[model samples]
Target: MDNASAITVFTLSGLNGTEKYRIPLFVVTFLCYSLIWVANVIIIVTIIMDKNLHEPMYILLCNLCISGLFGTAGFYPKFLSDLLSSTHVISFPGCLLQGFVVHAYIGVDFSILLIMSLDRYVAICRPLVYHSVMTRQRVGLLVLYAWLLPATLVMVGSITTFILKLCDSHIPRLYCINYFVNKLACTASVANFIIPACTYTIYVCHFVIIFWSYFYLIRTCRQSKEKMSKFMQTCLPHLFCLKILGVSLLFDLMYIRFGSVDLPQGLQNFIAIEFLVVPPILNPVIYGMKLTQVRNRIAQLFGKRDPMPHKAEFLMVEFESSCPNPPQDPFEGTQHRHEGVSLNQDIIQAFSAAACLASGSRHGLIRLGGASSGSHTLFRHGEAVFKLKQQVSELLLF
Candidate 1:
């Protein structure tokens, strides 16, 4: 039997037809990699900085984004370099390491999504005990378990493949996968079959948990509008993410196990790489757009940091100024008329100054009702104040 040590490198055949479009492919790959980093980093940072976002769902989401970054780092850099190279080969240790990272990435993704589903279930289905069930300590443990379990499983799988004697050193896909490495073994060990089968079965249970959580979530939400609204806003993004990952994984698994040579090489390649490309890009975009808190936090990160007072603040000031009541109708008597005009002027000046600051401009004062001759001027000032107030309100909302 030829020993595993004999094969120090494996040639990847996935780059077979990439020569004609290598440059274009490299450019696109580089851009996609950059985007994945930017998007994932933004989410991670947004979650980390905001104390309000330190909840279970957001924490799981942060880990999920980190997993995307981890998984892509395993593929894109090497793939980018391979695109520009003549020989597409990876050293044995490098191959094993890549397989470990890619596999761990996928496993962690499933784990985090599962945890997220459980989180949603608790938050929506069992709201009263969510805090007790998913406390800070427990959430930390869950996240740790999510990452650690996958890393341990993949590590064992990589080690199992590492010990095998190989008769061939060719990998059909663009990157190293443990299954492909196992295929290269001189003889299939029962452990190889059993371990992966068990791993798949375990993750299938995860899928079941996800589906079950969502089932109850859907059922519970239907009875109440508030729960239904929460489900649509938060749970939908998770479902979309799960669907995207599931489809990509299904294509890769199907093609790897039962794919025929009759299929086009391009289509085969696309199927193989879909999981690596789509999920990393799509997860952040979906969550950033769909989750209101995440969206607002992201906006706040890129937006200016001036604090705008709330609507209640404006109302409070109005309340305080009007507290000292005078006549029922100030304009009814000439004696109290000057005081009313002065009070009105003070209110207008204060609001105008606030509006100017909120608008980041200082042009003119917003005049109140003065004379019929200047009614047009007052109308114009009123319009500007209305627009300024709207802008301030929008800023405060974010």
Candidate 2:
């Protein structure tokens, strides 16, 4: 344990065996792993196939689903194997690869989540500029960077860390994480914790700022009483995502702060399984249940139909608009069509004369206007009746 050459491969003694519970544990974990895989795949597929879900928010979700898919795929197979066998041991190379993949996908997931938050911020606050700000090209670049940068950084870091390790044999917890595996190094120094602490702190600060900004955003939206309900509706889903993220962070911090730091042979493996394997399984279930859209989509996939609220609303508007306006004038009289609903010039002229006589001596009573042709005289009252008839005809026609 003291020398650089002391360990060649790590052995993991997983969860303390309670002989009565092994089969149930294996069955439960297996089903969870299977559900996670299938659910994430469905999410990805729905995002791709549904045009309604092709917006920036869903694009980010699809990226997250892909991240979770990879994250779970990277560790679950090994973890499941361990659960089945009740043995925890990972080869050196397998541990390194697992650590790298975990780091890469997790980094990518957070990076995308931050971008998604920004996307929501813009959509809610500066909706007019959201499209311009989150154009397809810009979002695509962010997605690429979210994935590639993390993969590259983790690859570089993992390779260097693996090379620096003095011992090849260290039993990783049920699976491997960078920190869990690094804990076994005879040469590990304060730098291991220091580097990760700084990196994690930077992300933590970013997350704090983003949450504060969203707080201001929610306040600003609430100021408009008209949008209060809609604001809540939109904010709820994002809030759920934030809550889950916060809960995960809380678990991580609590474990690091209060849980044992000592790298006991059996304990590291258990931590690995808890940290890497459990969270991924929880994500889709937590978010899926909290997000109405995802739940509705799932319901649809299961052949349940959600009545289109907007369409019904539109129909209601149309129906109300179709209801006849309260009768305006009793003498409005039934309109007659002449020359395919063109006004009846002779009749209008007659009515104009009667209206003028009945109204008494008016200065503009018989005011006549030249027609567009400059030859025909258009009587004022006649013109009024003519326009009224035209409007009535148009309305009826519609």
Candidate 3:
């Protein structure tokens, strides 16, 4: 213990073999880190700023992005420096700090996922009670749990490493981790192994809670298409994120515990780093794009507008093909009405299934013959309203 206490720095050998392509790797790593910050900040700011997005579900989503940022911030900055420098090393105190940040980030993430799955279960299966049960105050508590539980649990493990007299100062991996740091202890106490074992076990129970919630959700939604649709629309992103985090973390844990030394350095590096690399960037994207409200809000934030309201009942999505070459008056002789909707309005809307306003933008007026006054919108660029109102006899749109 006396000899081990003398060591104050650790050497990371993970980047030792990357001398040939280190520059390119540094460039890519820097971009990935930059992207992680931008993506997460966009989600965080968008949710905070949008009033309609103040629901419990979106609130939980904001935390997911926050965890992604927290976890990656622990690893990326130091790693980018390691990529450019000759020595991949960290001080003993710095190593423990990294481990705590990484572990606590993952711990918070697991708790958040568990809460998200249960939120879906309630919203889908017991919707009558969802609001009463998951109020803003309750959601605040859940967010608190998401942050504190893992932090407390991971802190115990980090502290044990801090007190241990580290016998080895060389870490064979990319960055600091509790599991790896514990291996540095001169004499392994049962607390060294038991604290982490208990932490991992407790967090693994989060998975049990998640599965318990989703199992009922899937079964309940099986009989109702509407419920199923809601499940797909809302819960799919949560489940997809779970899969991503689960796979990446699981592979990383497995690699660290049982990975073969014979494996190539590149594959080993990827396995070790994927948890930090993939989730931060992907979490924001899936949540932002997969969930309708976030996607629409993002579009609005960028000055784009949706011309049509999202309700499909009000929208007639039918389209038709335009003729390659046509007589000036294809529908000149006939006037038709489908259920009191004039041929004029029908052609204007359910025109060729081929050409319609993209994103239902009011921009890009389509000119058919001459121009008409109001209620005419361009499908794209600012043409005129399609003159189909001039001749709406028999428009053929399948």
lDDT of each: 0.76, 0.58, 0.74
Better of 2 and 3 by TM-score: 3
Off by over 4 Å in 2: 1-7, 18-20, 189-194, 261-297, 310-398
- Candidate 1 is scored at a TM of 0.77
lDDT of 1 by residue, 1-398 (tens): 64565899999998897799999999999998999999999999999998767778888999999999999999999999999999999999999999989999999999999999998898777764566788899999999999999998888888888889998899988999988988888888888998898899999999999999999989999997856876888899999999999999998898788889788888988898898889999999999998766877787799944253222112211111121222232222121111122223434443544344234323233333222122212212235555434433322221
Native-referenced Cα lDDT, model 3: 0.74
Q: Per-residue alpha-carbon lDDT of model 2 for 67-160, expressed as tens digits? A: 8878877877876676666556777777788878877877777787778677767766665456678888999998998888778767766765
Residue-level lDDT of model 3, residues 1-398, one tens digit each, is 67787999999989877899999998999998999999999999999998657777889999999898888889988998888788888999999999899999989888999999988887777764566788889999999999999999888887777888778898989988878878877787788878877887887788988999999989998987856887888889888889999999999988888989999989999999888888888889998888766887788889986564332112222222233332342332232223323333544444442133322334233423212212222233212223332122112110
Highest lDDT scorer: 1
176: Cα error in model 1, Å: 0.7
Global Cα lDDT for candidate 1: 0.76
In terms of lDDT, the poorest run of 10 residues in model 3 is: 389-398
| TM per prediction | 0.77, 0.69, 0.78
Model 3: CA > 4 A from native: 311-398
